[model samples]
Target: MAEHPAYPVGLRLTGRRVVVLGGGQVAQRRLPALVAAGADVVLVSPEATPSVEAMADAGEITWARRPYQDGDLADAWYALIATSDPDANARASAEAERHRVWCVRSDDADAATAWTPATGHSEGVTVAVLTTSARGRDPRHTAAIRDAVVEGLRDGTLVAPHHRTRTPGVALVGGGPGDPDLITVRGRRLLAEADVVIADRLGPRDLLAELPPHVEVIDAAKIPYGRYMAQEAINNALIEHAKQGKSVVRLKGGDPFVFGRGMEEVQALAEAGIPCTVVPGISSSISVPGAAGIPVTHRGVAHEFTVVSGHVAPDDERSLVDWPSLARLTGTLVILMGVDKIGRIAETLIAHGRSPDTPVALVQEGTTAAQRRVDATLATVAETVRAEDVKPPAVIVVGAVVTVGPATAG
Candidate 1:
């Protein structure tokens, strides 16, 4: 006779006692979600992975240093059997059954009465997938489906009207390094609920295009450029729309605080008494070079890396960059918005103390499908830039680290 299909339901494990009978890979993967769900997890294992040990040290979960013993599942509401030793796992599962606690067995799913479903959450909605039938399908297929559904929800392809709430406020979101997929989950969720989005040229423009038709999209680059006119207009726009009960999203590329003038906007909004929330994005200073296979700070090659904006010419009296001091550093140098001033910047570095033979890499439109890299020595980089016609929105890396290893090459 065949067994009946198990009934699927959500478990509210908040502050509930949960026992994990192993501290290996399966336990490592399951611990995070259990902790996140507010479960008081007790892990029983003689030895554990470094990560599990770290969690125990951090007080997120209680760890039993010794092996699992009889009555270990006493008073436990839920238990997981995931030990490498089959005998130990079987004993733990049997004990859990005696205590009337639901048990999940990683070793033999068919033998276990409870089945863990593939789960994912987006914008306050949790999605769980499970195969109740005895025909053993792959879990990877279920995970892939879960991922696709989550992506659709995040990118606005899948609509859940109840999940969206348009509160009057401003969100300063970092769009990450040019990739639409790189935007943070919270950022994407807020964007989906936004009434208006004021976006920069370098932000995740692809995401802006995916916004609902009713949502207003403003081009930040097209806003009038002046000492204060453009910025004031933006501030006023944010305040005015928000005051009218519209949720505004101010989206920029990379981290808003990293040379993105995010603080100024925050101050401006505060002075006007407009509510604002900041969602940090991935900074391109590191991601751009990394996209081109460059490590800003390698263990043996470079101990530190400095990121600077090269929009100003090296000889410009108004420029604040300390070129001579930078040239003296032995670590890596990453320059943003420096394509046009590469010639002068290179000249200044060489004139100071940096070697003319220093390896240099120019990554253009990094982290995107249009990404390209130009590699050359400091002395010849200017010529290479001109010959290759390297464009703006590029990252310039200088130091021996460029050519030293598998990192960004020169």
Candidate 2:
């Protein structure tokens, strides 16, 4: 039992000497935070785990590559005594005490001068919880509390409206290939704080249901060669909401920059003097193929993978893709927004030098419950799409890599 309650304080260890006596699991877990805090850490250990060795190789910390010895903590501002040898730990702790340096012991917490708390970070706030009682300490309970507080803060469930300084701006967030769980933590946090969400139809539609009722959700769904909201109108909406002092989030499917025309929105926001943040999402170009058990690049089979926009036909004057050059390359080709132009694309690729027998796969509604894969060859892909009734928003993979994984039948 601790003699008194542990006083909580944030350590500014930047440029200060920190000594870690162990290079095992405990050190592996705690070293990263110490490095992130800009601490000049010296690790004293005969050997270390692979991860700790990686940090030393990267020059993040100095590894003594020997067991702890006397005077090891002579210049340390802080010490973590976690060596396998109990005697060594006791000697290090005694030395740290004699030198007036605060020390934490992994084995004996009560004997240590300092205790590491269960810590969590949300936004710019750090929550550290420590439970010290005459009975005993509960680390798991402390960790659970920390996780709850951080999660609440991140999701806006524990909102302190009076204390929050709401900054009005526009954020272009990638919703990540139709899976709500796949959305980045930063993106989800920003979404929870949004006052207005201009959502695309292809984005993770499930997340919209979780938004607070006060948030205005606008359907800016853009369909290929179909009825859809104009890009100019969407930009105007973002500018209007931001100028009105509202936090606006443009939630897009896959990556906002992967043929998503996200730059246009950023440029528009800049012209209107609105602060914009772009959070990248997992693009379906790679992720969709992966979700359907297809690797864009396989060893010996494919060395490179190219992502192209298939929204325009190869014969169209607006098309900018060099079909002849693409066919000459022996690599994987991932086409997005090309469901309608699959026939023209396949025909053009074949005419230029690509083999007609090359494997082709179309992954529809990838990473979602509605996901399905339709397999064909470059020669039969156009007809396969027609027979399968494959719709828009499917990723078309053309290469030998299409057959690299287990057979994915629709």
Candidate 3:
């Protein structure tokens, strides 16, 4: 294999004709980026996954509403083929080259020219970490390790504002989905010492009951589907307080960077030369599912899994999710933003040959006393959730491993 030219900047696709070949959640996620990048986004799929249809109706993208065919790459600058079909991705990968367009295989990009970079963004700065297996799956793990790295970097000697730190501060640590015990020991240490605390409204009100009586607790929680504080502003408050040399903790609901924008906040601190550190929280992506008695991995049941956010739709219609690979995979699938896209996600899974009757569990407010697990299969999970009105801050676990609850004494 040859080295492709270094990416121009962050993995943002501004002003590029990126063709997304799927209409599922992952495609929904990548599609928004293509549009945000000023790409003349054209989605090639027979059906509009709900997210895609919404984006299309909102005029965020152009829709072809068809499967990949010959000349689908006609005049395309870059092609991202993300179908549930490995055969489709492979075929698309081959066709993209013949048309002289840059192509990315959603599952095979690492071996090819297109790759998604690790992204961290803030008001003042943005950092993207891209790796090609030369360093292994650092990009995949970056999402996991990035928070800790930025936190230390912000507070370590690397940042600026050299002075006698004197004000009360807090570390906005993500408590991960719901297991207070899952918190990084360091996060627990800081929370134990907090003079004042700010936490997501979605989290347990009692999670902070351990704080001293004199400690002030503020609910910075954002109401779902309603008005809320801009997350950046919340981050700014944490940094400013720390600048006063005060111990501050900006507690997030789950893995901060996963979908909560901890990366953006850390980047802001780095640029401002403020002191900060990230404490890894047990991500809801895994914990929530686990709390539901679903082992994210089992010896014969599953060997690997993918965690993706349901926060936003992708600008590129093509997603990198290899349905064939995933279907053939022997690992459980845990979705963080699972509730929001349950219908579309299940649709795609079933469409791609995954058994519609495959067992799945959606755990709401996982790991806490308020947690509830609704069990069903891929075919019925979405409808069941709607009927039950199960909400977000939930984890959706899909696989045969979910056939019987992992903790249910099979």
Candidate 4:
């Protein structure tokens, strides 16, 4: 006789007990989705990955610091058996079966009562896929299908329009490191729904170009507020558009609060009684350096990393940065908006006791197709930058961490 088909249903596991019988990679991967669904998860294993341990430390999940016992799943609404030891997995599955709780076994799906589906989430929707006809077959096919569905949803090809009940508001979104693909799924979805986009020069311009023709795209740099009133004008634009019942998106480059003046806009909106939401992006400070294969913080290399704005010259009266203190650090120094003043900045660091030979890397147009790197040291960076004609919007990395990454140079 043929076996009964496995039922496919979304479990409302919020505030409900769930038992995870492993702490390795498979369990690590499944725990996040369960935690995200508000499951009261208890992970059982003598050891766990650093990520799982971190989650336990953060109170996101409970960790039983020992191997699974027979009654581990007695109160669990669901159980996932993911231990590497087949014997342990079998014992956990057997206990779950006795308790009448459905079990998903990572080691052997045919020997399990449940199968975990390939899942993808976009906007407010979650998609889960499981192939019944090819049960216990290769998971790659299902994962591929999931990716295709997600791509369609992101690009507006798979639209499931929902009625908006809330009043129009502003979203301070960070477009990561000028790469269109680097923007978060939430950020991209919000961008597609925006009626008006007030964009900065450093944001992902390609994504802006893809906006629907009916949407209004304002150039923030060209805001007609003169030089001094530019910020005020942008704030007014966001408030005015939102008051008109239009969804306004103040899209900026990198994480909104990382030298992006996002809070200023949020404050302006709050005083105007406009609702505001912030969706942070991947900041270029760390992402740009990583793109160049430079880890900002490497074990035993850079214990600490500081990010500072180099827009103002070190000796300028308006500068608030303590160059002397920065020069004393043994960690990495990442400076943004410092290209124009890099020459002066480099000289200041060297003068403040930083080694004349400290490794420095200038990543221009980082994380993009036009990305280029120029290497130098404290004593020679200014000359090297000038010679390379490095422009603004480049990240300046200083310290041993630069040499520690794959793109290390003199």
RMSD of each: 2.7, 2.4, 18.5, 3.7
Error at 396, model 3, angstroms: 0.4
lDDT of each: 0.89, 0.91, 0.70, 0.90
Number of backbone-clashing residue pairs for each candidate, in the order shown? 2, 0, 44, 0
- The runs of at least 3 residues in candidate 3 whose Cα sits more than 4 Å from the true structure, single-residue gaps closed, are 1-170, 222-229, 313-330, 404-410
Residue 240 miss distance in model 4 (angstroms): 1.3
TM-score of 3: 0.53
lDDT of the structure predicted as candidate 2: 0.91
What would the TM-score be for candidate 2 when compared with the true structure? 0.94
Writing each residue's lDDT as its tens digit, candidate 1 over 171-288 gives 9999999999899988998899889999989998889878889999988877776655888788778888889989899999999999998999999889988889999999999998
In terms of lDDT, the poorest run of 10 residues in model 1 is 401-410
Alpha-carbon runs more than 4 Å astray in model 4: 1-6, 15-100, 103-113, 133-138, 154-157, 406-410
TM-score of each: 0.89, 0.94, 0.53, 0.83
Q: What TM-score does candidate 4 reach? A: 0.83
lDDT at 133, model 3 = 49
Q: Please write out the lDDT profile of model 2 over residues 34-150, one tens digit for every residue.
A: 999999999999999999999999999999999999999988999998989999999999999899999999999877889999998887778998876424787888999999988
Over 54-74, each residue of candidate 4 has an lDDT whose tens digit, in order, gives 999999999999998888898
